[model samples]
Structures are given as C-alpha cells and as structure tokens.
Target: MSLKYRDEREPIYTCDRVVHSETIQALEKDMQGVKISMQNRGLNVDVNKLSALIDGVRLDKDKIRDSLYENLHLKGKVNLNSARDIALILSSQLGVKLRKSRTGRYIANRRALTDFNNPVTQEISQYRNLERLLSTLKGLYTATDKKQGKVSCIYTDDCPSGRLYTRDYNLQGIPELGRTVIYADEGCTFILADYDSFELRIISALSHDKYFKDCWAKGLDMHKKAVSDMKGIPYELVTDKERKLGKMLGFGLSYGQEAAGLARNLRTSIHQAEKLIKAYKSNIPEIEAFKQETIEKARSTGFAETYFGRRRFLPDIISPNIVARKKSERQAVNTRIQGTAADIVKFSLVALHKAGFKIDTMLHDGILVTVPEGEVEDSIERIKVIMETELEGLKLIVSCKTGKWWSDCYAKPGRESSPK
Candidate 1:
C-alpha cells in the first residue's frame, strides 16, 4: 500500500517554535536556580559508610569464592567476573546442572538461577550489585564540585521528549537511595506534584477505553479496577499482588510487550502471562484494536503521529528484517503513548512557568517545585489546576506533597504532608 506521509515539517516546526523560545528561557532559569540551590545545600555523601559497605561486600565475595574453590577443588583462581568462567566452573568443573537461557547469557545470570535459589549464583549477583553501587558512588564523588560544594549537573534541551537531561553528574539517573543525599535549601521546602498514572491516563483518554474511563470517573484505583474487571471479581477483593500484576500488564501493553516478555518480567508461566494479556484485551478491546491499527498505519505510511500531531517516521516498520520491523512497530505505538505524555508534560512545564511556579526539576511524569512553607498549599492547588487544565479533553488526577527534602515527598492521595 502506498501511504501518504504527513508533512513532517509542520509538527517539527510547531514544536520548535513552541519549545525553543520562552519555554527554553524559563527552563534555563529554572535549571540555574536548581543548580544554585543544589550547590548551596550541597548533597551529603557518607564516604566512610560507602567504603565500609564496599569492604563488607568484598569480604562476602571472598568468602563465597573460597568456599567454592574448596568445594570444587579448583586448581587456580577463577575470574568470577567473567560470565564464561562462572559458567565453565559451575557447569563443567562442579557438575552443576545449568538451564539454557533465552538471553544467551551465562547460567548464573539467568532467571532460572534465582528461581532455583542457587546460593553461589545469588552471591555472584550480590557482588555485581555492590560493585555497581560502588561505581555509582565513585562517579558521584568525582563529579562533586569542590568550589561550589555541590554536584552541578549540566542540563540539555535536546531530548525529543522536551524534558530536560542532566549531563556530567546525571542527577536524573540517581537511584532512590542516592536521592536521599540531596537536600532542599534550608527553610525552602520541596513540593512535588506527580501526575498519577500519567501516560496510562493519557492512553485511556486517547483510546476512550471504557473500563479505564469508568474507573477514573468513579475515582477508583485504575490498576485495581483493571484486575477486578479482568478477574470478574470485586475491586476490594483484588489483592495487592494482583493489582501490581494488573498494573504491570497495563503499562507493559503500551510498550508492545508480548506474552513471553510479560512472563519473564512477572516471573510467571507463559500461560499465566497470556491469560493476563487476554484479560486486559477483553476488558479494553478498543485499546487493543487501536494499537493494531496504529501498527498497520505505520506499516503502510512509514510513520505515526502522536495525539497532538507530532510525527515519528518509522521506515523500519516495513523492513524485511523481523527484529527491526517488530522494534519499529513497538516504537510506533510507544511514540503515540509516551510522546503524548511528553507533550503534556512539556505543556505543564510551560504553563507552570507562566503561572510563576518555581519548577525545581521536571521528572518524567512529575514536577518538583520549591515553594515557601506558607505558600505550599496554594502552590499545590495552582499546580494541579495548571497541569490538569493544560491537557484539555482529558481528566487526570494529579497528586501533590510537601517535604523539607526531595526524598520526603512520598506520593499520597491528597494534599497532606509531614514536611521534615
């Protein structure tokens, strides 16, 4: 089918004009303020503690290695870091039965090792995790600006998502535990306004999925509602685990996950994963149809567009290579969902700026604003209004919180907080 491609210049030009001028200026100023605040209230890293942890991890690793060497009667020291070495030692030398992993990784790195509760494999995994943590800490330590007494992250506006990216220190890449080291400027509390289930809500609005819309309308937990609908059970009767599984499946659908991938992620049987996917599709047939239509459209047109008409050219969608074509198909669907979410976030940032909210940071689906203690309540309300209003034709439930530090802003239902 010869498909007509929409003039890509229009959407690109529109996005450039909208985001390049005042939006960039506002973001620049926001980033400057954030950098200064971060410097002034420099993040505290306990080097001693991190070093101790590293030492402990090394000791544990050594103990495991010594035990393994003795048990297997190995001739020389084996490199545990080498997946090949580990596989040879376990499979060939030690006569440990190893299953073939689909990922083509060593048996020790496979999911089956965790399922079988292999102590040796678990120890190796623990060692790797600790080594990763140590590397991250080292990076942070080296990146710390001694003159400014803070880690200054360079921001870029080049991301297609219209969201900011941090270079050098990579502030956005910091793990939750790492985030605890950062503190807000004294007397100036942190206020986080996160759009709950932001992209899923956008997808629901876009597809006009009845189950999703009905759940949102009734102020029900969307994940729980999905489980309830899928299982034909009362929402209250759905367990937390079931709700989590439902939530995973719901979000995974947006990423074009197949049954095998879902099964791997949820650590369930392929049959169970298929059943979950079936349930979700049965509950929201429209969304499934929409996704299929999107892939077909992209396959025909060599491109797809987001809700606001942002085009993503997908020539690979029609590629002869199965892997490349499948990837492009997934990207086509994801671009519509994720790209729209990005547009909404960008819109929210611009709106929030015009409304005079001090945007500390713009996370993937959340905005961290700094508000004075007295103005926290008012700021939260205004932020909610701006974010919700900017995304016209959609009803989203935004959650807000106040905290003395960034880590303190644990998301809750309403505007209630114990700002420490």
Candidate 2:
C-alpha cells in the first residue's frame, strides 16, 4: 500500500569534519608556560599512559621505558626530553599556559589566574585521550569458544537511537551493541557465554569510563576475568540496524511511536510500519489514551508521575517552538513507559534478592536471576509477581526458561545471535 509519509530515513552526520591541528592549537595552546619539546619522532601510547596524561598531566618515565622494552610493536622510542618539549609545545599551542608557584610548583593556566575552570572543557580533553586508549586495547583481543560451554539463552537486537550515515544516505542503527562484537574498527566480536554472562560483559564495558571509576575499582578485576574466560568467539555485537530496531520497538512503544516513525525505523515505507504501530496502540488503549491525558495533565498540573512517585519536569510542554512542543509530547509518552519499566526491574531485583536468588543481569526491561534447578520456577513466579505489582500498562510477556549450561540459557530478544 502507498504510505502517507514525508521522510523515513534516519539523520546522517558528517563525522569527517577536518579539525586542523592549527585550529585546535589556536583554541588550546597557551604560551608563557613551561616549555615542553616534542623531540621524539615516534611516540608510543597505551590506555594507561593516555589516561595518566589526561588525568595527571604527567607521564611516568619508568612506565614509558618499561613499555618500550616489553612490547616491541606498541613501543616506539622517542627522546624523553624531546617528548617533554613536544608536550610543552602542544600545551602552549593549545593555550594552556604554565606558571611557577611560590613553592616552585608548576601549574596550568587555570591554576595560575583562577582556581575555577570549565569542567566541560576539561572533560572533553580527557575523553579525547581516553578514546585513543580504548582504540589501543582493541588490538589485544584473542578469541576462543570457552564460553560456548556455558550455553544458556541468547538475545540479539539493535539500538534505535543511534544514527549512521553511509556515502549517499543516512540510516539509524544501534552502535553500542556493535561496539562489543567488533573492535572500534567494526570487526566481529564474540563471547562464549549465555545472555546473562554477556549482559555482565556490557556492564563491565560501561565501567570502563573514568567517571565510573568506582564501578571499575570494585568490578574491574572480576570483569577482566569474565572477559578473559569467555573465550573471544567472534560474536557480532548488535548492529546499528538491530539496535535502532530495538529502540524503535522498545522506546517507541513507550513514547507512542506513530506510523511514520515506526515505518522509518523498521526500514520500510511509512505505510507498512504505521500499520503495525497502529495495531499495537489499538491493543493498548490506556497507553495511547495516557499520551493525550499526560499532555493535558502536565500542561495544567505542570508535572508527570512515575510508578514510584518519580517526577520529571514537563515545563517544556509550554515551549514556544512547535517542534519542541511535539518533542515533549513524545517524551511524555515514552518516559512513562520506560520509567515504569525501570522501576519494575528495580522492584523485581529487590524481591528476587530478598527471596534468596542471586540476581546477575539487570536490563531496563528485564532481570536475570540465578537459582537452583529446584527453585527456578519459584524464582520466576516471584519475579513476575513483583514486576506486575510494581508496574502499570499491559502485563509483561515473561517467558521463564532454565538451563544446565550458561550458553543454553541466555536471555535475549532473538534466539539465534545474542545481543551485546
């Protein structure tokens, strides 16, 4: 059937913006500072080194020498004094001036003139090196099928919110899921375990962030073991397409995805996609009605409620921009569903743990619990009850399954390939 749609394609972005070093230098270089010379033509860097440089503004001389001696491929030797000169030059070019303190201590521009500095700028600079660090670690991967023995359930899907652009067109896909499967270069990545095991892996990846250092400190050792033991089996991380679909299915359902959006995300013309969305809405009248009611209620009352009294400000509903007004309407629709789902997961986890099951994996919509075979059914019953009691809208479609092996009992959207 013909579709009543204007544009169904995802927005494309130009990631290849040529950022000249000169421009960056213009913005960041500070002169009248401690001079650092880049005498070394070849420089070697790892995640640790890059992180330290960003965080401490200094690199360990012993660590650099050890890296050079230990790893031939990753290590490229450059004169240490030259490297310091280079750093000083780069620092000056970036507008980061250095000054001497009364105590003979050296400081950056922020410390010299004012103690206050832009947190966002500092954050961005740190992240720049951190991104490079992640890239370096990608090469260290070695794959095995040890995780396959665990054999539990497998779930695979995509992130709907991530947008990707090809040469001629723009498309939407789930990039985060794919990140795990392939190196940053988009190669295949695999873990030999079940869904729960894989879910924990994703959580570990999240802990890699410096701000999440607490999670890293507590979970890093355990996480590294999990990664190492899984046997790099070359599993595909959820692709941009699939992630986009999952987002389309998951988030769209919450925010009341209309025909046009549904079709676009589904990669079909609007006519086909909208029909499915309409059928879904029709099956859940309250959810659809809630969308309109929320607009009115929020406009009049100035707030929206969550399952557990979680409130999100909705002042944007009265925005002057019609686009923003529409966007707020969508936010109200999705937030109600997603927020309630989050609460249900939390409630289920608490009840399951109280009931003596070891909860292993937690998603926005689902929870994974490890229990003895004798108590599997009982655990499932408790989880369902807690989720139902704590959540609203249509009842959840919970399918309880058990496994003797991890790979045999993973929980994923699809049965074939597990979602990363």
Candidate 3:
C-alpha cells in the first residue's frame, strides 16, 4: 500500500563514496608532491598544468595523437592501464585525486548480469573505504515516495524529492533493438537512450523557427502540446502523468523505433504510429541533421570523442554484413550524438558542482540538481552555459525553468514532476 519502501522488499547495496571525489582530491595533492620529488630526480614536469590541459582538451584526432604518442611516449598502441596512469598523473598535478576504481561485493553484483561472462572485468573493485562510507551511501539512497505517506496518483515533477512510483497499466512492452523482452518496468530502466536523444533533437530543431511550422510540429512547444494532449484509459489524467508520458515518448523515439511498439502500447494502429513519427521528424530537420552529422562524423573520424579526453572507438560503421553494417551505422550515429549529450551533462555536472550545485539525480540527458534557493538561478545559468559551450562545434539551445515545489523544476517548461 505504501511506496516509500519500494526497494525495501529488494536487496539494498551501498558503496564507499570517499573513493570517488575525496580520494581523488587527496591523491591529486599527493601527486603534486610526487611531481616535486620527480623533478628533484630531473623530470621537472608541471603535473598540475599537464593534468588540466588533458582534462580540458577534447579527444580529437590531433589531441589524441599528441597526448598518447608525443607526450606520453606511447607509439601505435595504448591500453586502459596506461590511460589510468595518465589520468592519475594528471589528477595528482591538479591536486585532486582522480576517483580510484573500487571493487567489492557491491561492484560485483552491479555488473554481474551485464558482464557475467567476463571474470576479469567482474573482479570486485579494490578501493579502501574511509570513515562512514556505508552509512553516508545508505542515507543518500533510502527509498521514499514523493508524497511522504499518502495514497496519491503517480505524477511527474521537475525536481521530485522522495521516491518515484509508476502505476502499472500492464501494457505490453515493445522489444528494443538490442535488449530483448520489453515491457513497462519500474524506474527508467527500459527507456531507450536513442529515443531520448531523438526527441530532444527534434525539439531542439523545431524550436529554431518562430511562428514557423515544419513537418511534425514537434518543437519544444509542440512537445508541451503533445504531452498535454495525451489520453489514457480510465484515462482520468493527473498533473504529473502527462509529463511522465512525455518523457517516455521522448525516450521512445530517441531509439529509432517505428510504429509497431508505440502503436501497440497506445492501443492505436501502426499506421497512426507511423504518421506520428513522420510528422514529428518532418517538423524537425535539425534533429535529422543531428543524426546525420553524428553518423558522418563518426565514420570519418574512426572514433567518438568526448569533451574531455575520453574516446570510444567506432570500428563497426564499415562492417561488411548488411545487417551488421546497418546496425553499426545506427550505433555509430546514436553513440556520437547521445555520447555528446552525455558530455554536455557531465560538463554541466562538474561545473555546477564546482559552483555548489548538489546534484541528486542524473537522468540520461537531464539532471536533477538541488541548490540553496539563493543560488538556484545562478547555478541554472552556469549549467546552461556549460552544456552549450562544452562541446566545441555543436551550437545547442538549452533552457531551464525553476520552481519551488518538487513539481516546479524546469529544464523545459510544462512538466510538473521531475523526470521519472
């Protein structure tokens, strides 16, 4: 009957929070000292400056070549171990300990299902826990409902506090490209990353013109309209329900789904679903361009680069098998664009954190950041700038809305509850 204890019936796990930030900072300071010692040995390297340079640099071709080969003296090959060493060195110079990878029972269980086959990768992380690590982690992760102790309808919020509860309509879930057996699940697990990116891209593209209409009419404003227009069976809609659906639909289309799954879920015909998809895409050519740009860039560059020096190889775009090739193309497309979106969010998080924004929840494209009332507006502007400027070439239009209640948070207006 109560929702606060949603996870109470399930196993709970906590981790050593110290390893992530605090340890990194300590290591950084120690590394600075180490640099001085190494300089006494004649290395004379400016570790801090070097680390800042690496973290601040984008992982483009020239940067990668120069950093890995020229600076680090690794020619023609590299490994994760080396990457970590470089990161560690940089962290020391910056007077911040890069978070040490931790392994333990918790880490094992978390990666168990996804990486069951890799015993080496599945090894429990080996990071030392400092004071009160478990307790701090537990305090932060306790499950509590949005409404303290009331039987309330599930609604969306912009900055929801407490736990989240979704009513199960028992709708048949559609199968996504990679994952099999899809149905509505608790939390945001089944949400597709591609669909989320596509929806945002569509909104971003359409919002470019004023009093101007295009194909799907699915700009940010139109998204508000479409979300507001949703109808459900027993369908007495509540405030947060529409926003929740909007988020779902947004994530759905982001993954490149056609009409089958959506129509089935909506109890609508596939034809109608196709119509909606086409209309949405037509209205937002910019979204289409985003997709095209990512694919083209990935194919040309041979790797997907992030704002920082992180790089993911994109070797499959030129696969030989038709199915494999097409799949890789989609992967390449989604990874670059979606990955860039991730970079923006991460950049925003680091910047906001530096500016004192306490980030509570991080969804794929958006974030749930909580700051003192006096600092919310400034934090918002800082985040917007971070997201926009972090990615070098992409000119993104990021907006936010601020409200007092759990429902008042706004990345884009019209949503009362935070993203589910």
Top candidate on TM-score is: 1
**Residue-level lDDT tens digits of model 1 in 258-305:** 999999988889999898898788888878888888899888878776
TM-score of each: 0.80, 0.38, 0.38
| Candidate 3 lowest-lDDT run of ten | 170-179
* lDDT (Cα, tens digit) per residue for candidate 2, span 1-420: 011111223222221232112321221122101011111111111233223333432233344444433432223453323324323533544455445568755443322223325442243234333444433333221111223211111221121121111111010121222112321111211111112222222222222222123323454332232222232322244345443443354345545567776764555788777655554344334444556776777677555543333345567788899978777776654444444344334444445545554444333444444555555556566655554440111223354554432223343534532222
Model 2 lDDT at residue 341: 41
- Model 1, runs deviating above 4 Å: 1-78, 92-94, 97-107, 110-112, 156-164, 390-392, 411-420
- Candidate 2 clash figure, as a count: 58
| Per-model tally of clashing residue pairs | 0, 58, 31
CA displacement after TM-score superposition, residue 112 of candidate 1 (Å): 4.5
Residue 346 lDDT, candidate 1, scale 0-100? 63
lDDT for model 2, please: 0.37
What is the C-alpha lDDT profile of model 3 across 333-419, one tens digit per residue? Answer: 444445445434444445544555444334445554444556656665666655554123224545555543323332235653323
Q: Where does model 2 exceed 4 Å of error? A: 1-251, 266-286, 373-378, 381-397, 404-407, 411-420
